[model samples]
Target: MRLIYCCGVVLLLTLFSRVSHGGNILVFPVEGSHWVNMDVLLRALHSKGHNITIVRNSKSWYVEENSTYYHSITVPVERSLGKEVITHLISTVIDFERGALPVTSFFNMAVGMMGTFTEAHRIVSEFASAMFDDQEFLRKLKDSNFDLVLTDPCWGHGIILAKYLNLPLVYNVRWLIAGEAHFSLAPSPLSYIPITGTGNTDKMTFLQRVKNVVMYLIGQTQHHVVVTQTYQKLCEKYLGPNSDFNELSLSADLWLMRVDFVFEYPRPTMPNFVYIGGFQCTPAKALPQQLEDFVQSSGEHGVILMSMGSFVSALPADMTNEIAAAFAKLPQKVIWRHKGDRPANLGNNTLLVDWMPQNDLLGHPKMKLFVAHGGTNGVQEALYHGIPVVGIPLFIDQYDNLMRLKERGGAQILQINSVDKDNFLKAVEEVLNDPLYRMNMQRLSRLHRDQPMKPLDNALFWMEFVMRHKGAAHLRTESYRMPWYSYYSVDVGLFLFGVFLLVLTTVFILMRCLYRTMCKPKVKQE
Candidate 1:
């Protein structure tokens, strides 16, 4: 559909459109088990007068959208079953090669190669799934049409869907996508690149830096190539009259970062991108009685909330024991989220549970510090609670994000390999004793909470903007049309400059030879 945007008519049209769309908004969140955050956004948006229909293959279902949120095992909306399978296969191969499942070394090589190859495959899979769910989602719209399409950026599928359906699109980035150098496109510099900070502050050892760079290249190269292909293909298959792949990406209209500026300070920003931190946050509910009691029982020294996010589960039991031993030394109570039977020799001031209300735990006034695996969402929650962290980074962006936080003086960065008694206890002690750390966290928390509008509100605003303007043609960059060499300034300009330099050097050499020959007299000719 070719949507034309005529000035002055937009406001009137938007008014009419708003009146027409009294039903629920259809949201296509990323595929996986941790879509609880997305469900929160959907429910919250629905409460603001729009109904919500969720189309995902996740296990959990929203209480309100039971009718609209389809739960088919093979619904097909996820980016690509084939690509996902390929990623898994690569991960497995990496695991096998490293002789470890969670190895973050050369495994990046496999991730990059596999991530790119599967892009097209994943896009196809998600499109198929959307086709199946479209009928149901559109049915709800008859009485009240879908107001906008808000999607997780990880699923490039959403951008394509918005273009195809002529609906408003709001791109939600779950991580940091700033920094002059691509930051390996991991969102945050600390997460994307190695050798962060300088001099004494550099956390990575020499070997680690080499490993980090290699891993970053492998994963990012694959991501850059694959995402570009997937995005372009999506545009070609969908976008509008004069629209192509280049136009869609460059002119995204509105970009939403699911991160707070507080965490990524002194950032270089663009007008189209807005910080929508705490999108994953839920309203404060009373904690479970038992959990509350556990916090109360901690008393004077307070407690340490330890979790390894959803993806990287608890370390091996032996590693867990090492961590437990470290916790034993601290006067503070420890609440560890380990999905196993309680440790046999559990310490007096410690508790172990499969899961706890993570946000609730972080929110507790008595919560002293968090020991986490440094996932972006978890880091945001910790920052929100004004709590310092001991980030025991594992894989993906965890390490880099923790490093960034550490640089900002908000947390202590720890390595997974060095998670024993000494390092762990030292980290805990430093964060607990440092008044500056807590002060810094509070400063960031104030900035985070003081956004002009709620993150969801901002997201909705952008969604409507896309609808209001149809698609922002003025915002698209024309550079994507140029060849890669040209785009990188390796085109005619650089090529011609190089040729001139070569000619000058050759003439100079010839002139020197001529002068030397003439000076040598006629002896050679005679």
Candidate 2:
């Protein structure tokens, strides 16, 4: 017994020593603190004994319960290479259309850069801008002995930074990104190809499935061209002025995604992708005192949480009024996250604040249903709390995510354009009253939480894995080399050929039997 105890202590000490010296990880958030995933991921890393530093804005405050050694510096928004000139030009065009550059423009640009001159231009421009930060985040990245660089897809700069530093990059995606070649990165089956094992797109409705196919087809050429061009430009900046775009595209290495499986269930996957979502150690602080008091007043009625997210609040005044009116009539109390202080004729049943503690509110026992714009973070929070939701998706992935939640039976969905008091009230009522909705949400919550290891630990482990392997080159190279047709082999020619062969065989067999019967002497007598 003494010998066994001594051996166990020795083993633990060895393991602890290895972990204490784990590789350094540098994280770059695509967006500011408003992004919930950023906070969650950082918290997860800190908990798992990983050394980390953030290259982000000073104003971007993310809560961490236990502080770890980190460097925080604001990257100046202004930089030259005059990339902003082109960015602003594109922004102007989009602003004209929707009063903003719009996230779709970024998606479009990402797809277009796959194979275009603009792709090269954007790559150089982004690199220049990223490295030009006044705080010298790039310089620190170079000086620091970082094992891996983790970043959001929106922060393409991280790719260049990793390349320049000869480090491995782990990409994080907050939402489902549809692949032109195969299935969408989202949890929904809408991206599946029927015959090809790439995905099972059959899980969606006929109309939605058709829509997915069409979208994929239309975006294919654009994505390829854009990515190819951007890679070329990136290569020229790093490799040489004479480097070919095609070769650069081939050399580009980006880890697909590093999210947790719980948030994206039932989605098909390949080995290169990693999901370490819900990395935030735990939910943030509870709701404020004033907010708590308002909810408690509702008693058995409970409260409904509503938010349109941080980036876009394009809900027209008329629509806002309609929503207010609907909430005014509900038996439940309403706590809305609206940036503006605009007063409405809503009854005492409503509470509007510039911002609300979303996760904390979801954790509340009195909280009943969540009304959201269906962003990934919000969806994760709602799922974590096992609260049924009514998703009024406005733009981008919101529509698709809302549909996913509805399909999962944990929420009701409503289109933004068609929303009114009646529809809004009805949707809220359905989520609140329907026991199945709560049960379904609870089921999803269990699945989300039932992972073998916490998302944070997995994220840190993988970050270190990539570091130990000295850049996950094998995964990236393999993922890139896979051709679209080969990846999703829904070959019409093969199907046709198989059918033809089957028909010919059947005909030949039947003729042999018929000829024998007709030639027989007994058949003639009959």
Candidate 3:
């Protein structure tokens, strides 16, 4: 017994001696669902003995003043987003559905981003200026001497902060980002990948490709005009005279994109681009007693969950009435995630609440199908649980996600405006009754789970990989350094075309001269 105890102690000592503490990592998460992204990563890093400080601009589930895992700094930011911007953006989707927004759904998103850019810029600037101007706060924040900076490029301010701290930067792309913010760190061609808001699939026709190209061109033409001015001014003010944000975005050490071929189609990615999709996910959790009772009370009929995400809480009265009517027709129990007033004449089979354990609810054996507004998180969760989806996508990437899910045969999309009881009933029936949907969902779930390492583990591996290699500059592709026209080979194509046209014109001119000389009136001249 004495010898065994000594051996155990020696083993523990050896393990402790082998553990190497990683560098300090600073995380800046955007407000809303994006905050939920860190549930796994931050805690895992903490358990591994790394210093993690989260910069909190608003209230969220992930952060507290003090925790065993991490520390959060409270920064008051007054600007409120989501409600008005999304309402307006979705109102345009009605246009696209009706063929009024033209062919380029990618360009239309740029227009929406244009309308909201000023507000986004203002909020980011205020947050940045607040951090910079506070003498004591700034001193304390800088005193930590962080080694790496991790940011969600929901806005373009993280790169600036990385510059301020003179630390290695790693950016997190929180969504598919097919069009909106992908151009800087990665390249997504139109051959396979669709635009973010456009309901296009990988198999696009020639005309669809043409529309996609036009959208890309329109996005390129207006991209710099809409976003860069504010970024440049803020860079000058906060980061010195010549510190441009554009240059910083391209030069970031790594880009962790929340995308994968399991959910998204295959696309070209650079060495610095790491796919960490579904990292925010977990293996489900135990349901609270109330939720457990609710599912149990449903008996063998099972239940369905309705969630429109955190940002979209309100539904038009007419839309609400339609969804309620559809629930009334179904035998399965209904659980809706809503905070506002409930629709009148809601069926006894239906229950409404502001919140429920969504992941747990999805993982329930009684969960036959999920009715969601098609947020990436919600859609991905439904996919993870291998539950067929009845998608009522509201705005932005939701539409694109819904389209992809439909193409994958695991979902049926119900249009918000055209969602009568019949259509909603049809979607629910199709998802629940069709065995094919379940089979497809199961396939995708397997693919998602079959990776060499867990998504969170893969994320941590790359995060530390960049830190270990001292910024991983060699992973950044030469394409980032190429000028826009040169990167697209537009200048080269145009130069070659111009030479061909010059030669053709010269030959035509000479032929005309020679023909005239041959047909000349020589006898008259003599």
Candidate 4:
């Protein structure tokens, strides 16, 4: 009887202990596909007994107002980046890509895209302003006594909010408002590490390197004038004149990067940046019976899965017809996630659904090739499942993501503008027929899986680590605090150059004097 009573007490103690250790985590997430991955992390944290509270805009496109895992705090905002805006931007970019004049197309596309980016940041800045203007909300946030702030730095709202709340900040980050998080945190040499949208691999020719440098300058200018302009004004008004949005954005205690060395080119990184690529992936669950039957029907030919990701619901009608026609030429069964008009040329073997279980389908034994738009999540998931890709990249970082896989001999990239039945068929057939593509991807999968700890677990540890230590100040570098001249040691180099010139001038003067003295006649010296 005493033994049983003691066991019961121990069980109760364990349960209480878990509840006691729960940390109050405040999250500020970005919308669309970014939120998809952020939700995965939030669920994981909730399962570990952490209490999560999310701050979202009332006009959120994806985030729900209610959830069992986390409490939602919705800020009322009049405007947001809606679906229509994104769809129109995509359509315009696609049209530019297919334009007859290449130079005009590229120039217009660059300007229009940058303008869209600037406007989006401006809208995000307004969202942050709305949050700040609410006195009751600010009081509630302060009273909550949150342990840390987890945010996606693509927008600057979270960074500014974290500063206002005086909480330790951590990032569920890939792109910053400036650009890729690595460029902001690490030593990214333009000679090697390819800038996003440049489409150059780590290995580059002379002209490519020149192009890389030009793009780097253009990107930096865009970040300053286009991206940070609105955020900077908000920072000055709320956080005081000394506050810099760019600096605060880089001041996070930890960066849980959504990529790993497996998918990224080898480059320098900092201690605080943790790679948790494919952390959202898990073993496949049982597909619905109907879907299972479809997979089984494929038999020896296997199945090909295609998805354009969360934002791109469908392609242009003509492009869709061309893709469908290409699929008709293949022996394999096809499952494409599309919400566009039904293509007239769609093959009987192809199944078009508004949505499908992308991750689960990729894990299926009969899965053969992935036709993807080169989003980070899809690409990482593909790598995780050891599936080779037939990449049809459309916009912004999609081409770059495909380029990385292509560099590794694991995928084939087709230009969206030029995609037609013949070229699309050839690309798909090459990836499907080629054994090397599968082998290389499998090798990468093994490498990704062989890690000492799971990426998700590592991310959790770092998040909790920040909570325990109050912040990871020791792990974070002070480089962000330094000016550009100080960061690159340009001041030091200039000082050294000045000192060198001074010494050289002194030596020259002394040599002239000494020669004059030595060569002078004895009578003159006397």
Candidate 5:
């Protein structure tokens, strides 16, 4: 009886210890796909006994007001990115890609995208303003005694909030308000690292490098103009005139990057940046009975899964008919996630659903190929499952995401404007018949799976590490604190150049004096 009592005491103590170690985390997340990944992280944290509080917009498109995992503090806002707005933007992009002239297309797309992004940032800034204006809400947040702020820096509200609360900051990030997170935190040489939308690989020729530089300048200009117009004023109003939005965005104590090197180019990263790519991926779960029945019906042919992601519900009707016709010719059974008018050419071999378990579907042994829009989440999931891809990238970073896989020989790219029954069929047939594509993707899967620790566990460890240490200041660099000239060593270069010129001038003067002295006539001295 005494031994039994002792075991019970130890068990109770262990449980209490785990419960006591739980940290209070405050999260500010972006909507759509970003929230999908962030929700996965929050669930993991919750499982490990952390208390999570999310700040959400009342008009959130994906984030729910109620969840078992975390409590939410919804901030009412007049404007948010709704499904209609995103759908319209995507449709406009497709039009630009298909109809506009080559040079005109590039310029038009840039201007249109910049305008859209600028407005989105403005709305987010207003949302932050709503939260700041609420004294009672601010008091509640202060009283919550949160250990850290976990946010997606794609929007700047969270960064400013962390500063306003004087809390340590952490990022679940890939893109910032301007561009790729690496450009802000790492050494991204244009000679190798391709900028988004350039469709160039790390190995670039002279012309590609020129395009890379031009794209870089354009990205920087967008960042400057948009940030100065929106986040800058918000920072000046709340964090004081001295605070800079760009610096605050880079001030996170830790960066939980959403990509791993397996899907990324070999580029320099920082100590605080942690790659948690495919962290959302897991072994396949059992499919629904209807879906399983459909898969089993395929016999030896296998399955092809197609999804265009959350933003694009449908394509143009003609394009849809072409894709449907291509699928009809394939021996494989097709499952497409589409929310549009049924294509007239859709075959009996294809099943169109409003939604499907994408991760689970990809992980299935029967999954032979993936037709995707190349969103980061979808691409990583495809890589995780070792399924080769037929990439029809829509807009923004989709092409760039697929280019990474194509460069590695795991995927094939098809232009949106040029996809038809013939080319679509050809691309699908090529990926399906070629054994090399599958082999390469499987190889990537092995590499991604061979990490020292599971990516999710690594992310959790770092998050808890910050909680225990109060911040990851040791891992973080002070480089963001430096001015641009100093950060790039441009000031040091100029100083060295000045010194070199000064030394050269002094030597010249000394040489002249020596010649004058040596060549003087002896009679002059006498």
Candidate 6:
């Protein structure tokens, strides 16, 4: 798995240049903000001539019922699970930010994730029941003879199904949370790799390190406990009575994570772990006619784009208006992704759309600043386009991403709770007026772009590599065999300590005997 720079390796990869895989690839995309990056990989794999069938909720299955490059298998859902997911997610953050939730110990981030798992468990149960209960659907699915299954590890349904279907499973995760962090697929050392959601960078202060370890331990524990409890039922009922979901998830063939050492601290990663950061980005395309005109009409001031990503498309109505008020005051024209009815006081400079081409807007020459909720896809997109940001981070990993950018001088994070007109306006103006933000972003953009290969090319290559090798099991880490105590050398340290104690005790006993013999010399002679 070691990457070779030789001509042979190049020739081997070149062999796949026109490789149109005839195999069927099935994908199960998890709910929420992951769609941006997931779509990129699925589309690329489909374009490479693999039959890609995305089993998505019927509501969000935008793909036609029939197609050549891509198709959809509908898993009927009752309602938009979006509202429940984000409502619970935002509520957790609100509790933490207000100090209503205790953080002095393990309950810190663990409690929040318990709620998240419940939401995931609920949604996945609905999806799984729909899939498994329908005998026709189940028979058709098992007959598909999929070569591989692409999935989000947020839910265990994919892993369980892949195992049932006798196909290799590859986990493509958008979030780098504790569950993936602790997986046997790679090494994510806690000392450097900040606990996801905790806003620490690679270099942390003493207090931050202490907090990092606590968060790390708790997060991993919570993920294991909750997921095991929730998914074990599904696995037993559907897959097998004694089958464990966690073990199945860990046994996946490979992992394609939306992470890179450039954005994150340099850490050890197993060969099977692929970094496809900026996979959401592509060559910029023309904006919609209306958006193009708005930017054109703005002339010199440029345009500012604000989107909270798909998850948080609509904040509370009042909060949305308060935000719009800030945009109204800006010299630049505004494009806001709105999910609800337009605000009454909408400014002439602002335009509300259900969706706009996010990447295209960032790549636009006149995109002045991006105000975002700091989702990985949007953050990476902004970094790739070299645009300064006014980050309003909403949740866990978003906080860390925004903090990373803020520390690097490419952005300023306005507090999510304390966001009012003045504070929001100040952060926006600072990023807009400051040359450093632009300069820092340009440097980061270069670093992000200057990799040995394009992110998409790398993603395609590694996934193809998995196929070429029939599985990337060769790249799986040996850490899987190492026990927790042995992996950290704690047992060895204790063994050495025991030996030292034994030697010291023996020497002390001998010395006491010698002292007693010498002191009783006269009596001993008698």
Off by over 4 Å in 4: 1-8, 100-110, 520-526
lDDT of 1 by residue, 445-478 (tens): 7777877687777766665556556645465345
Per-residue alpha-carbon lDDT of candidate 5 for residues 1-526, written as tens digits (9 for 90 to 100): 9999999999999889888999999999988899889999999999999999999988989988999999999998988887777778888889779876657666765665788889988988899999999999999999999999999999999999999999999999999987899999788999999998788899999999998999899989999988999999999999999999888888799999999999999999999999999999999999999999999899899999999998887899999999999999999999999899999999999999998999999999899999999999999999999999999998778999999999999999998989999999999999999999999999999999999999999999999999999998899788888999999999999999999999999999999999888878765878
Candidate 3 whole-model C-alpha lDDT, 0 to 1: 0.75
Clashes of 1: 11
By TM-score, is 3 or 5 better? 5
Candidate 2 residue lDDT tens string, 1-526: 9999999999999879867776688776644323466666666566556777766542333423234555554554333223244344433433433432434443443344343434434644454455544346656667888877776654345555556676667766542112421243222244443312112234656765765665565454444555455654555666567754433233333443434455444456655566655555355466678988998998999999898776543355667788888888889999888755354657678887877778888889988999987876788788877889898764445655666567678878775546888988888887788799999989988887888887666766766677678776676534344544554564766787899999999999999999898789777788
lDDT of 4 by residue, 260-321 (tens): 99999999999999999999998889999999999999999999999999989998899999
Once model 4 is optimally superposed onto the true structure by TM-score, how far is the C-alpha of residue 215 displaced, in angstroms? 0.8
TM-score of 3: 0.85
TM-score of each: 0.71, 0.72, 0.85, 0.97, 0.97, 0.85
lDDT of each structure? Answer: 0.62, 0.62, 0.75, 0.91, 0.93, 0.76
The TM-score of candidate 2 is 0.72
Pull out the clashing pairs in model 4: none
Poorest 10 consecutive residues by lDDT, candidate 6: 97-106
Q: Please report the TM-score between candidate 1 and the true structure.
A: 0.71
Kindly give the number of clashing pairs for every candidate. 11, 22, 0, 0, 0, 0
Least accurate 10 contiguous residues by lDDT in model 3: 175-184
- What is the lDDT for 101 in model 2? 43
Identify the leading candidate in terms of lDDT. Answer: 5
Q: Model 6 TM-score?
A: 0.85
For model 5, which pairs clash? none
